[model samples]
Target: MVVIGSRTPTQIDQVPSAAQIVEGEQLREQTSTGVDLKTALGKLVPGLDFGPQGRTNAGQNMRGRSVQVLIDGVSMNNSRSLSRQFDSIDPFNIERVEVLSGASSLYGGGATGGIINIITKTGEAGGPSWESAAGVTTGFNNSNDFDHRVAQSASGGNDFVTGRIGVAYADNGRHYDAKGDEIFPDIAQSDLQGNRSIDILGNLTFRLSEEQTLDLKAQLYESGYEGDHGVYFPNLDSSTPNLEDAEIRKGFSADREPLTDRRMLNVNYHHANVFGQDLYLQAYHREEESSFHPFPYPDSDGSYYFTTSKQNTTLSGLKMLMSSDITGNVSLDYGVDIDREEFDATQMYFDDDTTDATGGLVHEEERVEPRYPGFQIDGLSAFVQSEWQPTDNWTFGAGIRRQHMDVAIDDFQPSGQSLAEGGKSDYDVTLYNVSALYDFENGHQAWTSYSEGFDLPDPSKYYGHPGQSVSDNPLDGIKTRQVELGWRYQGSRWLTQAAAYYSWSNTTIEPDDNLNIVQRDDKRRDYGLEASATRFLGDHWQFGGTLHALRSEQKIDGEWEKRGITVDPYPSQHTATLHAQWSDMTRSLRLQANRSWDYADYQGDEIEGNTTLDLIGSQRTDFGKISLGVENLTDEQYSTPWGQRAAGFYSPRFGPEYLYDYQGRGRTYTLSWSLEY
Candidate 1:
């Protein structure tokens, strides 16, 4: 494997001077759980958190701050909500996952946490390859599903052009309630509640000459969800026979369908001069849209009602990079990036007078309008980094960046009342990092670093409430100070890594008791230790495991609150993924098993934790590859991070009764197949 960056190329399997790489085999091993990129990295990296299932819209919090996600060096984060879900792309098309852990303001804004770069498959010149796969499976609950995927690529000519294209699709089935658990009759009758996705990607690379090259790429993604919400509730007491009238059970049947559409285009150029200096230029554009509909209620006139919400966002950027070797042992990289984003949202209400509450009359006109104020943000940043290698086994690195930002909000009202004129804010900040690594005997290395990071206030926070005057106080950005210490050991048959890190953040963003608007000035601290090891047990078996322990604290208004606050909800203690796989043991058979445990954590008023087991077996041959697997083998119950909202409880609400929880899928099984030519 070769590691390529905006500036230079580095060797793999060695202590990299300034870049990171993961081999293709490592990517395949990590993607055993279908196509969940986030979960695939949980065992390979520390200080990365993955939220529970059902919270599909939640973003990833890296090192206690929201991180930026990219594909082939192009940013892919949503401009409006900043959601960072890995489901946007299929894992089957990925070649590797490169994570630049720690503050990286030099790359771009919104990377206060870190940077995740996804590298896709590429076709080699003078080579041709193609692959296709299709399969079906059934499990204990409603786990019967189908999947199909295909990819093809061809390259020729020594220097003219090379291109590749790939596509994938997946349809998943829902899981049933565990034994002894009562199924929600209304939901049981609805369509399957699972995810369906389609992905399309294309790339073309042209070598203009020996000193220059051009690359163009595009991607399209669509995903959908069917059926009712996953949560459930028991019947009310006999005194409340109108239990049917309770907010939780008001509807005899409920269902919803949400969809997302995304498109991206990027173009890049690289040039090298006879003087050994290198330069790069890149321009990109992205657009995304999401629509959600909530099931409407039946009115007295026997009519059904529904509400529709949609968000549209667009982002575009250009970047320039240059690098050169100043001295025999010193090198420098400098770059500048500029970007802009625009966001808009709309909500619509619809009613059907076909049926009544008990066949009663329902009459209302469909009202559609903008749901939030429209906004735009423009930013510019420049940075420089230096690497010095004074000895064969010692290296040092340092980097700093300055960023300027301007945000504009158009005149608009959230509710249909008076218009609130838009406003603008400007900010300039600086960030820096320094690190050193020392190589020891036997391919081992120790490293340490100090980094500074910051997160800009989200644009949604700038709007004023209907009754109060819009406050002039701009949203305060969060500042982070981080310290890290770690070591890595690589051997012929084993690989191990251990790291410990602590981060302190000031002016962290949090919602008040009412959860109406976001506020800053809160303080949060997180410290954690993690270790992972992978070993080849004999010639046919491979084993690996990861263990982590973390502690967090938050201070509100100068007072420390250890519990009952909705700040940093990650579990303080957890053990993930102990797995063993036996491959090529027999003619064409492989067996694998894994176990994981999570400690209780609070999400608002609900506590969640669970232990899960999984098993898999597969057969391979010239015809194709087939595999079967089971997940959540114990049928453990759990709730996701942003699962539910309490009924009629808007602001300052507390207690379990006032909390709504999202439910997780039970035990499930899957069968898959793949063919290559």
Candidate 2:
């Protein structure tokens, strides 16, 4: 398979570092269980943490750090992440996903961990074709636990023009835990349950000439949930082992739950041969609006106060790429990228007594304010990469990128504070990478690489404070250095890949006293090992497994210590998976098992570990194809690593009910049917 996350297409086996590809077919098969892309990716990619599978990707860290998300080579990342990148597109319209592990600046900021590139479907060369699919998921223990989805698409192409269009809709319901108890919505970050979503995708390509083409892509995705229950606190002094979960208060409602709305339009022009080289240009625009959960806090008078916030983001960018062949064994790729981003948040205040009398939180229009000063980032980048095959068995590559950006913040007033002046900061930096791969005659290969990555600290965190001004140049982009060594073997009946990596940086992204994201000046280190192997038992039988172990620490005072949840939210040190598959032309069956090992929290407390199982099967019939998937087959009871830490941290400050870590979901069964013509 070809790996496109590297900014250039290359053979997967030729990649010097760790990487993986999830085919669209595989994605469809996995998502048929009603899980989102985050969960599906976690099940396939080693070293990627799936977090709590909530509405937000708050804890979905890739290789112990942040990941840059993209669709068709266009970035979907904002300064603050907002953690809603996954909601920008539906899995049903994706062609494939390419993942490149480790820090990289090849495509610019937010890749401190790695890159996930979603390739959308395009028209095929032939007559018109169409597909329709429907699916339902439920925990089986409750009537309200059912979720339903439907999707349809059509693709066709001709010598001059081709296009593809798809639409998907889903009505999500409640979720259940291992004990068949209703899972409460996450009051802070939000949950995916109890929402309605719709996604629309379109792609059009025009063959301007035999050697040139133009492509246009557009997408719109929206998901929203109106809360019908209010958050209630109970068990103010419960211990960890005896903590009670938070209960939903009926007849009370939040003014608003959480919401996500995203839209994108992209155009690309390509010339297969531009003066004996390939030239590609892209122009794109994206707009996003997201609403966070309503929060309640105590006022100076001891009365309750409420606040709700929403973010609005606008992005526009242009990119150019050129590929030239210097010789039969040498090639060069160069590109320039220019982009601008505008982000701002608005918060509305509510009075407790008024909200109570109104039966829900009542928005006070006069009390609205900017949650943070609006910010705009304008960036320009230039890069060149080269690859050379010195010998038949040896390949080497090198690349460098120069980056420049200007961050401008608008003046604003924080709550209970006067206006603070905002200013602009200019940043210029250079990043480099090199790699080598040696292929042996026996289908064995070894490779090594050193790469650098850069990131922009979430500006909203620092600018939203009392001072209103941007914090002490904390926007000074984060720079990371990483080294990796990998080995791979591709034999007649087996395939294996393994890698060991170590990365470090001088600055760490963590939370401040007010629980806002901030960049701290401290040396940090992250090391990990990952491996995957697959064996072909026979024509119709195969087995595969993966293992990953990561360690994250930071220097504080004079000692090196494990990073806390506030610093590194996803601290699951070890993960393992095993699966067996049997497939024929008309039918298939698969069984998979996953385990998260017990690990010590930053407080030196042991977090319990758990394992889960999944069973999936499919059969093709004359009318359509039928598939069944059972997730969490054994109904294992466990707390996510992040959930454990959150429970410990929020319990005392807010009620012990916070100690109820969002428990893992119980066994769920999904039934789906699809037909294509």
Candidate 3:
């Protein structure tokens, strides 16, 4: 009902951009902080901007660019993405979450601006059904910081076989904010939020007779952590100035259990009359791996050594689809896509003196990663879309796409050879989009759209320094242009939406927080306005709200520079969210609040803004359902505008104890229970 399913390319029944849908009964009333998906999409979506202790991504800036995290549709970044991709999985294997919000010229090339699809958990349409769930969350300033979760599933089969199986697990502890500190971990953070996670899923279907169908799926995810003491900080002499005890974390050592693993597999086939068209076919594969153990090197005789780092990413794909009906009112959809990818990194070293001048812990001598190369990519695509409705409420759509790309690099060398020894990057381009919609009989609805998207350039800038090649125009691409207008209403209880957008870019890219290095900026501009509403007060109460405003600019020295305006980025020109709910029947209760405003950082200076409040309650019975939640109810001692712009631009020039460990995990409380049959 929140705009029917979209697979675009002439399947347009509706679309004008600015789309959203959360379902899963609103993820069971917010599963008490929901446990990632960036904490349940930071309160039901709105140009996302978290980290006021809600952490997910402090900059996925939907309307300002950056977004394209999918699940059932594959692609979880990994093409050199470092937004941590909202903790991979475990929203209890989600079953809903679809947001468009901006730029999606047929869902290609980093989505240029937005698109997040997460659709999992399937199996239920006839026969046997079983679902089980569990939950726990703790914090009132430390009950050992708590976290827990468990899940199970069982689906049924008939009509020639159908199946589903699911499993889940999560564990966490150690989190403190609102003056209670504790988050100072290191190494880019992500052991699924540091320590413990597991998920597995499977599904199968084969209904041959009913128009032919076939499906298969598999997935696995893992995260873990181990530390002996962790945390170390001290003004490192950045022109010292009485630092706040180096932001505390007291420098200790030992950490040899940092891991992450991900896997995926998929297959599909459907037909409902081929030649006349309705066919669909697909194939997929994925893999991701990460590791970091003991890091602290210094050997050449002076002793003390430890290093073991690794990362591997592999992706594979294939796809095809068709849809036809051209006559009575028009219809057409087309597709063909292919992809292959690999990203690899390595590092090794051992010997950390188990007791004396480094002898007892030789640990299989090593030293392999430093200028390591290995980045590959290949892609091919084709597309077409069409839709037209001449009567009822008028609608029209258009689409086109063509993509071809190739980038390669392997052959490594030069730990010291003066530089220049790597190369490769091939290119191809063609992307397009157009839209329109209107449906009013008093219910209201209106839309308009134009889209084009692109992004590519960051193969560690050609195999990360120390000698590089391939840069003159491997068909250079990094373009974006978008425009949008929208309005919607679905009364009977009230529901509303509004949108306004504008975008321009020739390029934009960032990275350099603690120096991961990667920056590119060129004429860029972004504009925005968004509005939302929901109402129902009759039987028990209900009210909802949302508002967002944005602005981003660039062009450097020639004026027009407003990227984070002095540090406090996370795309916050203005943001607001309000919620209220109360129910009858079994029982339900909800309360939410959010706000972020107070801009001007990119050298313009001035940053400070925060407001948070949350609460959730539920009760249902027939043998299942119970929940309670409270997050930062008021314990806001805040600090998260990406940790106040990384402690106002790198804490005193890079060492104010590196403070800004997102000080806002404060007030927290949660309880959960679940079941269904």
Candidate 4:
């Protein structure tokens, strides 16, 4: 199979890194479990940490680091992450997902963990075709706990032109835990339940000539919460600690609700041969507007004020890549990228004098101000890589990239803080990677690689602090170095992969004791082992499993210790997943089990772990294809790692609230129907 480990397409066996492709069918099957893309990916990928299935991707990590998300070839990430990259698009439009594990400079910043490239569906050479699907989900705890979804797509093409368009809509409802308690919505980060979402994807391709082509693509997605429920802290007025979880009170009305809107457009061109080299070029634009839930924060003087936050971000870039053969045994791939990102955030205040227990009861607007100084970052980069097959069984490759960034910020003080004004900052960095692969005739391959990746810390967060200076910037870029060793085996009925990796960075990002975002110039390291195996039990049955063991630590006071919840909040010492599948032309069945091992953090908190099971089955009939999914088949009771971190962060300052626990949803059932012709 062909894969793009770098910009150039190459054979999977020739790639020096671990890579996996989740086909559309697999994605559909996973979606049947009524989980979002983040949760679905975590179950399918061994090294990816799947946090609570929510709208915010707060604790989700790939290989214990940040992951760069991409749709088609356009980047969905900016310096100031909204933590909503997974919600940028609907899964119905995705043809497949490509996952490249470990760190590398092959892409750009924000890939310190790895990369997840979502490939959208494109029309093939065929007559007009259409696909439609509908699904419903419920936790069964209450009559109101029901969700609905519908999607449709159409595609048609001739010899000269081909195109496809798809649209999906979902109306989600409330959720409940195994104990039959309402799952409270996260007031700060927000949650996915009780939300409505819509996504649109369209693309057109033209065969300019036999050796040339052009493609145009666009997508728009939006998700907004209904705000039917609000958080109620039973201990809000109590001085003593209360063990009650944050409760969800119904009929909580609000004039404004949290929302996320994303828009992207792309123009891509390709030529089979240009000056004896294959050429590819793409120009893209991505824009997003995100608004958070309004919450009340107490001022130093004791009065409380209601505030909401909104962020607008835009990214535009042009990328070009060319591949050529230097000789029969040698090849070179090179590319150049020019991009710019501009971000702005605003905070809106609401008069709190008339507000009730639920925040933002008073609709009277007060004022609006910049949450942080607006900023624009421009980057220019160029890279080249060469691959050589010195012998029939060996391949070696190396590459380097030079990046230059200029950050410009508007002169403004952080809200509710006395801070130095923002100005300009410039940075230059060069990153490199090297790899070697050995292939064997017996379907076995071994590979080793070393790579470097980097990302600039969120300027908006650091710049919002007091006494900040552009020259004395605390938003230093973090550079990570990674080394990995891996082995892969592909037999007639069995496929397997095993890999070990370690990554280190001198400067780490974490929250201070007061839950304030901070940058610590201390050495931090993350190490992990990952493995996956799939076997065909028979002509119609298959079995597979994945395993991951990870640890993150930092040097403090000249001693190494496990990172705390504020830093490495994933809390999974070891995670494993097993699955069995049976399929035929007319029917299919799948069963999956996932387990997280218990572990302790640096603060000596015994983080409890849990296990869950899922089952899905489908049958095709003359009317349509019908499917049913049961998530958490055994009704597991567990608190999300992110939720636990929330409790840890709030307990010291406030008191125990039910919402702080972030309990996992209980058993859920989804029924779906689809038709394609």
Instruction: Estimate TM-scores for all models.
Output: 0.84, 0.95, 0.34, 0.96
Q: Give model 4's clash tally.
A: 5
RMSD, one per candidate, in order: 5.2, 3.1, 23.9, 2.2
Of 1 and 3, the candidate ahead on TM-score is 1
Candidate 2: residue 188 Cα off by (Å): 1.0
Query: Could you tell me how far off, in angstroms, the CA of residue 537 lies in candidate 2 after the best superposition?
Result: 0.9
- What residue runs in model 3 are displaced by over 4 Å at the alpha carbon? 1-15, 18-37, 42-78, 83-103, 106-108, 112-189, 192-348, 352-368, 371-421, 446-488, 496-535, 543-580, 583-677
- Give the candidate number with the greatest TM-score: 4
Per-residue lDDT, model 3, residue 375, is: 78
Clashes of each: 14, 0, 8, 5
Model 4 lDDT at residue 556: 85
Give one digit per residue, the lDDT tens place, for model 3 in 620-676.
Answer: 899888888887788787665556554554554443425443555777778878888
Which candidate should be chosen as best, given lDDT against the real structure?
A: 4
Note the Cα lDDT for every prediction shown.
0.58, 0.81, 0.67, 0.82
- Compared with the true structure, model 4 gives a TM-score of 0.96
Residues 100-173, model 4: lDDT tens digits: 98887877898888888898999876879999999999988778799899999999999999999999999998
Model 1: residues with Cα > 4 Å off, grouped in runs: 1-35, 55-60, 82-84, 140-159, 180-194, 226-257, 295-308, 352-365, 415-418, 462-464, 467-471, 512-515, 557-565, 568-573, 585-606, 641-660
Number of clashing residue pairs, candidate 3: 8
